[model samples]
Target: MRFSGESGNVTSGIPFGLASALSQAGSVLVAAPVMLDGADLISATFVRSLAGSLSLLLTVVLSTERKAQIRSMPMPIARQVFSSAVIGTGLGMTLQLYAPSGGPVGVVSALTATTPLVILPLIWFFGKAHPPGLAWVGAICAVAGVALIVNAG
Candidate 1:
């Protein structure tokens, strides 16, 4: 949340962004072989279940307060869990099913970067966040850049 000093500003999110990117890259790298070997669905489900279990265990072990917080906000927690189950696990498995058969990891990963574009419309329609014009423009540019990279490869 608050990343910086008492002012709660002037903090760079680059490290967090890099960590997320690296994590996703590692997941894709690990899953690619399984997918190419034609065990994608099983591997994806196993990985998701394992990760979710470990995450829950870690949270319970490390932070009782966090667990209490989650329990206190049941609706938000439920929404997050549902979204993760659907968008993260379901979509990931679906992607793995098609990715290896259709193209290389680079193309699939590049295409995956288009999530922001998908989220933009969803946020506008379902959520209360009305992103600015520049946000939409940036999302478009990001998708275009990924498209160019995939096509170039």
Candidate 2:
């Protein structure tokens, strides 16, 4: 698969798509246990942050170029990392706290599928990139599918 425009080219989607799906599955696995155990959101977030920090540390230690790469990364990329940490880790986990204990994990996971809907507009307005009409259609369809799953759950 390929997508081309001002953002350049995406020659393949399979690897990233699979990685995203697996990451979501792992999140649900971790979250369901914590919710079932009645763990506080703060503690859950702390544990997650700690784990992420350790993983970062391990990667930096193992990769000689990692520290330099981070140091030289552009401000926009750094800002994105910060935003993702705040939104994906902090806000997202906080929302999961409201999930009913032992309720279907699918509901919470499905909610995450709305990210494209949120991202599409952000890219258009903030990033000033115009996605093709098909991209909008796909994003809308994704949100609709997620909504259906949420309603069913």
TM-score of each: 0.71, 0.69
Indicate which candidate wins on TM-score. Answer: 1
Q: How many residue pairs clash in each candidate?
A: 0, 0
How does candidate 1 fare on TM-score? 0.71
lDDT of model 2 at residue 27? 69
Tens digit per residue, CA lDDT, model 2, 78-145: 99998988887787766665564636777777776576578778878987778789888988888888
> Which pairs of residues clash in candidate 2, taking residues 3 or more apart in a chain or in different chains?
none
Output the lDDT of residue 2, model 1.
24
Clashes of 2: 0
User: Global lDDT of each model?
Assistant: 0.70, 0.73
Q: Candidate 2 — which residues are off by over 4 angstroms?
A: 1-13, 50-69, 74-80, 100-103
Model 2 residue 52 distance off true place after TM-score fit, in angstroms: 4.9
Worst 10 residues of 2 by lDDT: 1-10
